[model samples]
Target: MRFPRSSGLLLHPTALPSPWGVGDLGPSAYQFVDFLAAAGQSLWQILPLGPTGYGDSPYQCFSAFAGNPGLISLDHLIQRGLLSYDEVVEASRRYDLNADQVHYGEVLAFKLPLLRHCYERLREGGAPDMAVAFTQFCRDQRAWLDDYALFMTLKEAHDGRSWHDWEAELRTRDPKALAEARTQYAEAFTLQQFFQFLFFQQWLPLKAYANEHQIRIIGDAPIFVAYDSADVWANPELFFLDAEGKPTVVAGVPPDYFSATGQLWGNPLYNWQRMAEDGYAWWIKRLRAAFTQMDILRLDHFRGFAAYWEVPAGEETAINGRWVKGPGAALFKRLEEEFGALPIIAEDLGLITPDVIALRDQFDLPGMKVLQFAFGGGSSNVYLPHHHVPNCVIYSGTHDNNTTVGWFEDLTEEEREVIRGYLGRSGSDIAWDFLRLAMMSVADMAVVPLQDVLRLDARARINTPGRLGGNWGWRFRDDVLNAGLAHGLHFFTEMYGRLPPQPEPDEPAEDATTEDELIYDPVDLATTA
Candidate 1:
C-alpha cells in the first residue's frame, strides 16, 4: 500500500525511559505516544518486540510470536494488586541505577522474579474480567503459544541451555515425552502463558492509543530466525540443520563495509525449497503475528529474501559464504494472498542486487536510504538524498550505525568536507543537520533514530554490527524529551508538511473501497526459490 508523506522517531520500547528497569507498555509508552503527537510525528518505529535470547538482541528472539516478558510493567502489576508497591519500589531501587543505558542483566534479575510472582497471583484468580480476557487470548493464540510456552518452560528447566542440549526425547520433540512434560511442568507452562497474556494485554491498549492519536506503528521483522530460537526448535525441518539440530549452513553477508570477513550472523539458513513446497506457511504465520502488533512492518534484510549469503556453520568468518537464491517474489506473493495488501518497508541496504530491487519494486514496497551512507565518498552514492526515489524512506542513521553525533566525530577531514559541501551546513550540530536533511528529502517518509534527536554520541549507540556485547542497551533519560527538542522537531515537521493531524471526534463516514480491495497485481506472482 502507498504511504502518505510523513516522518517519525525510531525509538524501541526498551529505549523508552521509565522508573522501572527497562521500558514497558506502561505509562512511559503511552507518554511516548503523546510525545510523538506533540512533536508532530505520524509514525513511531520500534525494533522487534519478541523476547530476546542470546546477547539480549531483539533480532535474535526466543520466539517470533512471543512478547518480551522483561518489558512488562511492574508499576501496572502493582496497580492490579499482582505486586505490592513496596515490593516494586525495592526492586526498582535495586535496578534503578542505569539512568542512561539498560542494564539488561540487572533488569532481568529484578523483573523475572516479580513477574513469576505476578503470574502466580493471576493463577490464583486475581481479577475475574482480566482472567477471562487472558483465557480467551491464550485460546486465540494457541497455535504458536502452545509450543512457545513449552519451549520457555523447557529452557528454564534446562538452566537456559539451547534446546539441542536437552535430553533426546525433548530435543527431538517425541510426542510421549512432550505429553509427560506438559503434565510435569504444567505450572511452568501456565506461568509462561501468563507472561504472554500480560504483554499482549498491555501492548494492545498502547497500540490502540497510538492509532487513536492518528499515529501508525512501524515494527521490525528480521529475515532470519536465530538457531537457538523456539521457532527452529519447534519446526526443525524448515531449516538447514543436522539431525542433532546444529545448522549445516548458517546465514551471513560476505565481505562488506561492516566487516572484512563480513558479518557471521550465525542464524540457521532456511531450507527454502521445503518452505516453498508448503506455501511458506511458517513465514505467513510469523508476519501475521507481526501485523497484529503493529500497523506497518519493516522487513529487515530485504535483500536476503531475493538471495542470501550462506556461510558454512563451522566458519569463524563469513568470507567462505556463497550466495544462495532466496524465495523472493514467491514468498511475498503468498503473503499478499493470505494477508491482503502488505504495508511493508524493505531494508534494502548493503550490496543490493538487481533481483532484490526487482522483487521490492514489484510489490511497490518502500526501500530505505540512510543519510549516513550517503557521503562516505561522492555524490554518486544512491543513499544521497538527490539520488533517493520518492517511494523510499530516508533515515539519518539506523540502529546498526553510530549515533549521527558519534559518526560525525569519527569522519575524516575529506569526508567531512564532502558532506559539508553537499548539505551546505556547518558540522557543529551534525545530528540535527542530517535530521533536517532527511526531513526535507523528497522520500515519502523520514525516520530519525531517537539518539540523533537527543544528539547523543557513541554512548547512546544502539548496535555495532560486527561487535559483541554493550549493544542494544541505550535508553533516553526522562528529561530528554524537553519542550525545546519537541519544538525543534515540530517546526521541521510543519515546514515539511509531515505533521500528522490531531485526533478529532469520531464521526461516521461514507463507504469506500479500502486499498486491500484494489485489483491484485500479478507482478509479485509465484517464482522459484
Candidate 2:
C-alpha cells in the first residue's frame, strides 16, 4: 500500500547513545522518539532488529524471529529488581563505554554476564506478575520460540559450534535426542526464553510509544535467512541442504559493475518447491512476527524474491552463480491472504529486472530511491527526484552509502558540478540540500540517516558493503538532539507537506450565524435515515 507523505531518521536502536557499551531500549530510545515527534516526522526507519551472529551484522542473524538480546535495557531490569545499579556500573567500567562506536566484543562481555545474572535472579522466585507474563509470552510464541531457545541452548552447550557440526543425532534433530538435550539443559533453555522475553518486553512498549506519537516504524527484513540460523536448523526441508544439513547451494549475486567476482552472501537458498507445498507457512509466521514488532516492513534484497542467484556451497565468489527463478507471486499471494494489504517497502536497489518490477507492482509494495545514486547519470536517471513516483521511499543516503556530506566530498569535480547544477546551490551544506531534495520529492516517504541530519562525514558511515569488520557501530552523542535542530527539521517537514495533520479543536470560534451553511449532526442523520 502507498505510504503517506512523511519523513524520519534511519538510526538503528544500536546507534542510540547510552552509558552502556552499546545502545539499548533505555531512556535514549524514548528521547529519540521525542526528537522524531518534535521534528514532525510520522515514521521511524530502522535496520533489522535480529540477533546478530559471527559478523555482528543484523542481516546475518541467529534467528529471524528473535529479538537482539543486546538491545534489552539493563536499567529496566534494575527497575524490575533483577539487577543492581552498582553491578551495571561495574560492568560499564570494565568496557570502554565512552567510545563513540560500539566494540561488539566488549559489549558482549559487558552485557552477557549481567543478562545471565538477571535470568538467574528471576528464575529463583522473581516477581509474580513478571513470572506469569514470562510464561504467557513463551506460550504465545511457542511456534518459533521453543525451537529458537533450544537451538541457542544447544549452541552454547556445544561451545558455539553450528548445528551441523554437532553429533549425529543432535545434528539431525532426532526427537529422542532433542528431548534428552532439553531435559539436560532445561535452565539454559529457560534462560534463552527469558532473554527473548526481556527483549520484546522492552521493544513492544517502545514501538507502542512511537505509534502513540503517530510515528510508524519501518523495519528491515532480509529476503534470505542466515545459513546457521534457527530458521534453517528447525526447518531443514525448506532449504536446499545436503544429507549432513550443509547447504548444497548458497545465495549471492553474480558479477556486477562493482566487482569482477560478485558478493557471495553465503546464505542458504530456500527450496521454493518445498515451501510452496505448505503454502509458504514459514514465511507467513516470520512476517506475522515482524508486524508485531514494526508497523511497516522493508523487504531487503527484494529482487531475490522474483529470481535469485544460486552459488555452489564451496564457491570462492559469486562469479559462477546462476539465476534461479524464485517463488514470486505465489509466496506474496499467500502472505497477502494471511495479512491483508501488506504495509511493505521493497529494497529494489540493485540490478532490478522485469520480473522483479512485475512482482513489486503486483503487490503495490513501495520501492526505494536514494539521492546518492541520482547524479551518477544524467537527468534521465530514475533516482533523480524528477523521475521519482509517489509510490516510493526516497532517502538522502541509506546505511550502505556514506553520509550525504561524505558522498559529496568524495565526488569528482565534474560529479560535484553536476549535483551543484541540479540543485542550483553552492553545496556548502550538502546534507541538508539532499535532505530538502528528498522532502520535496514526489516519493510518498522520505527518510534520512541520522548521520546526514547531523552533517557528519565518512567517519560516521554505518556500513561498507564488502568490508567485514568495524561496521554497524556508529553512535550519536546524547546532546545532539537540540531544540533548534527540531525546529529546522520541522520547517522542512511543513514546507514539503510532510507534517501530520493536527486534530481540530473541541470548541469552535463563536462567529455570527451564517444562514447558508448547514452543519449536519451524525446522530440526527442516523435517526432520520
In angstroms, the error of model 1 at 68 is 0.3
Candidate 2, residues 196-285: lDDT per residue as tens digits?
878877887788678777899999999999988899999999999999899999999988888899999999999999999998888888
Taken over the whole model, the C-alpha lDDT of each candidate is 0.85, 0.88
What is candidate 2's TM-score against the reference? 0.95
TM-score of each: 0.94, 0.95
Error of 2 at 482 (Å): 0.4
**Candidate 2: clashing pairs of residues:** none
Best by TM-score: 2
Question: What is candidate 1's TM-score against the reference?
Answer: 0.94
Q: Per-residue lDDT tens digits of candidate 1, residues 1-529?
A: 6799999999999987787767778888988888888899999999999999768999999988889998987777787788998988777676654766788888888888898888777778887666776676667677788899999999999999999999999999999999999999999998898888788767766787787777899999999988788899999999998978889999988997657888888899899999999899898888877887889999999999999999988999999999999998899999999888899999999889899989999999999999988886666879888898889999999998999999989989888888888878878889999989999999999999988998889888989876788888888878778788889999999998898764356865434433122112111111100
The worst-scoring run of ten residues by lDDT in candidate 1 lies at: 520-529
